[model samples]
Target: MSSTTETVVIGAGAAGLMAGIWAARAGQKVVVLESTAQAGKKILISGGGRCNLLPSVADISDFYSGSSDNAIKRLFRTWPLEQVQMFFEYEVDVPLQLEGETGKLFPQAQKSIVVRDALQNELLNLGGEIRFNHKVTDVKKVGGDFVLACGDNVISAKKLIMATGGKSVPNTGSDGFGYEIARRLGHSNLPNYPALVPLATNESLLTDLRGISLRVEWRAEKNGKTLELGNNDLLFTHHGFSGPAILDASHWIVRDKADLIINFTQVSSEEWRQRFIDEPAKTAHAVLSDIVPARLAKALLEKANVKHDDRVGNLPAEKRKAFIDVICNYKLAISGNRGLAVAEVTGGGIPLDEVNLSTLESKKTSGLYLCGEILDVIGRIGGYNFYWAFVSARLAGESTK
Candidate 1:
């Protein structure tokens, strides 16, 4: 059946559902279209199914974007974090608690379905409707309204919000279809790659280190300049490295082909050398184990060609210096990444400049708006991406008023 509405939001994930709810609250007839048989499939699996709903705190600097930083800053300022939190607490009635160490906010219910149901119910309560199993195959803008073609019926809207997300985690229904729609509707999209993904390398040492996890400082560098640096837990996988630190820096590796380096001890070369001098009688393995994991320490010693029982002071000068360097500045040649299938988010899409920062309305297409991962902004893991989805869609929905 062909139907027309004042606003039609494509893709009923976080952004689309949000846009529909707000638009309906604004007294506009709103319909949200979803390709999947269900809504918020990605939400169901995020944060290991607990659904990190929002960050306890968010700053503009926490997000990466190729467009003007000032523009992104303005968009964030439009919807403050406290206001969004209150909306969940009061409107959706989902009490949130903070994960102290990570600063992530989760529903007190501790289930992602709680958050999804809150959104779906809120939209329905506001008289908004969601059409599941309605995949938008094509979109066209004629004269004053946007026309969307689904399989057997057409949907027409005076205004359109595209929130189909990015190419990451395709099984959840975000398959980069929104980018194709954006391009067809007169917008130029940037090259997109998987972000927040694990890095893989064939380094033989990693095989022995699998299942080991430790805190590390990882740095990504390109062209002799550092691109991104983060300190978090790193996990040794059978393939390579997977953890908060490596996933956070994967963007630079995939985008600019940056070199990956890690500081296992978070200690400077001089500091390590001083430790060796201070403990002359100790075996190198014993001294290293104080800071590094035992398995990793043994592996590093092996890689440096230093005997595990070698006394720190008795070692030759070259051998002593070599081990110190390895501890402080170990570099890995990243063969590849786990790709979009397992990636937490995507790196690139329609640049922010293509839309009005105030409303996320397409600058080229008069009535089209964009939000969510389909945009160029790639927030670091934690709840920052969800924050962007909620805030940006709120702005787009309220703009309809």
Candidate 2:
């Protein structure tokens, strides 16, 4: 015999939990099935465990989606950030504190476990049952009911919310299984890729400059067109670049096979050239060091084949031009990304158009809905991803109720 429920939400991650909570609140018998023994595994590791739960601001322009921008706006507008904050503070009993510097909102306790536990407790208190270790292997819609197969046991629900997340961070239990279920249930998935992951570079200069961090103007260029210009702090990792700037711009790099051009000095080539000419007698290293780190100044000179103590006025015309270009428009040889294993979020999933804008119900299958990273919405470094999860899941759960 199969156990049945009013609502069955697959994967008890951020989206899954939120959906379960809302569904239970609406008097539905909800069972949130999690593959792993623990809930919110990804949440446990987010923001280094502090858990950046929401972004300070969630502009539709801040998110990337294959769906229309207006569609994205409507979804976000459904549950604004203010209401989300209130829900965490009052309903979940977890006060949120915003980090002024990053515009990321964390629990006042500054703990990821706190946020996870609070949500789980709220759901349980509201009569929602979370069956951990009950990994639903397959789902099928028969008439108006959805039948979910979790190994030998079968659980059926009038409404099924697919919050299994995307392929990124597979260890967190989202192994792209949600897409498979969606495909089998009659939905098209977009090309999936790792988003918010660090870019890999084999540039010897960048390798040597590991640990050197600075504010850079990072640009993604493909063919002759420039895609995005992200201005943020960029950190040089042992392998490549990993920071807010790189991670935020990574989707563009991965999607378009784009080239990365960084303005290390945050100045244009003409401005840097003019500065060099103005300080004709000053050594290039001396003038550049004031603007950039001393180590980078020395490395740039070496890369340009100019002596560290070479005066700007004494440098050959070609050498001076080369040095300016190196500093102002440095191109990184991006070999590849760190892949989905270490990615913060997955880039692609089911197209948003496939789901109803207001309710997030599947257009192809009745009583089916999709939310979270399972949809092709990629948010930037802050808490925009979580913002999407909370908002979308809330709508799905409420709509089912």
Candidate 3:
């Protein structure tokens, strides 16, 4: 059926839903279109189904962009995370619980449905409508309104919000169709890559370490300079590293390949050396076990070619340093990433510089707006991405007034 509205939002994820709700509340007739059979599929599987709704902290520095750094900062200043949280609490009527010290938030039920249902209900309550399975085949702006072709029916709206997200997790419907629509409308898009994804490696020990997770640090150096430093839990998988720290490393690895140093101990070399010296009678594995996991301790000792019973104090000074070196700086060669299928979000899209920060309206097109990961600002692993979706969409929706 062909329909016309004041605003037609594409992709009923976090941003589109928010835009529809706010626009409807602002007394504009709105309709949100979704490609998937259901809304918020990505939300359902995020954070392993609990769906981390907001980060513990979403500072300006947490985000990165190539074209619109200033625009991102400006957007955050106007629509801060605190304001979004307040909106959820008061307007949406969903009480959110902060999960950890870092300020990650989730619903009290800890299920993604709570967050999704709240958004759907709020949009409906405000007289906004959602059209599921309405995948757009093409978009054309004739005169003053956006014309979207979805199968046999045509939809027209005075304004449009592209919130289809990025290329990450295509199975959940973030397949990058929005980027094409925005690009055709004269918006410049940077090269997109998998972000918050795992890095692939050729390390043979990964097979042995399969399923083992340890808190560690990944240090990458580029052209004799420190390029990235990631500190979080690293999970060893049959293929490569998968955990928060390694997932964080994917961002750096994608920019430029760098030499990696895995600090299994997450401790100082001098301090760890002292432990070995103080316990000369103990086996190297036993001494190392005090700092890292026992299985990793054995692996590190084996990689260093140090005997398990080697006396730390009696060993030659050079040999002792070599053992300590392995403990402090275990190196790994990064090949690539596991690809977008397993990535949490994508990096790069329509740069924020092409949109007005205060309203999230397109600078190139009169009525087109952009939000969510479909924008160039890709944040670190946390609730930061979700926070951006809510804040940017709010600005776009309120701009309709």
lDDT string for model 3 (289-383, tens) is: 77777777777888888888887777778888888888777777567788889889888788777888878899999898888889888777788
Write model 1 residue lDDT over 306-327, tens digit each, in one string: 9999999999999988888777
- Single out the weakest 10-residue window by summed lDDT for candidate 3: 99-108
Q: Model 2, 200-271: lDDT tens per residue? A: 989888778889889999888989799888899889899999999999889988987888888888888888
TM-score of model 3 (CA atoms): 0.94
Per-model clash counts, in order, read 0, 0, 4
Over 4 Å off in model 2, which ranges?
Answer: 1-3
Q: Name the weakest run of 10 consecutive residues (lDDT summed) in model 2.
A: 1-10
Order the candidates by TM-score, highest first. 1, 2, 3
List clashing residue pairs in candidate 3.
Answer: 55-103, 56-102, 56-103, 56-104
Candidate 1 global CA lDDT score: 0.89
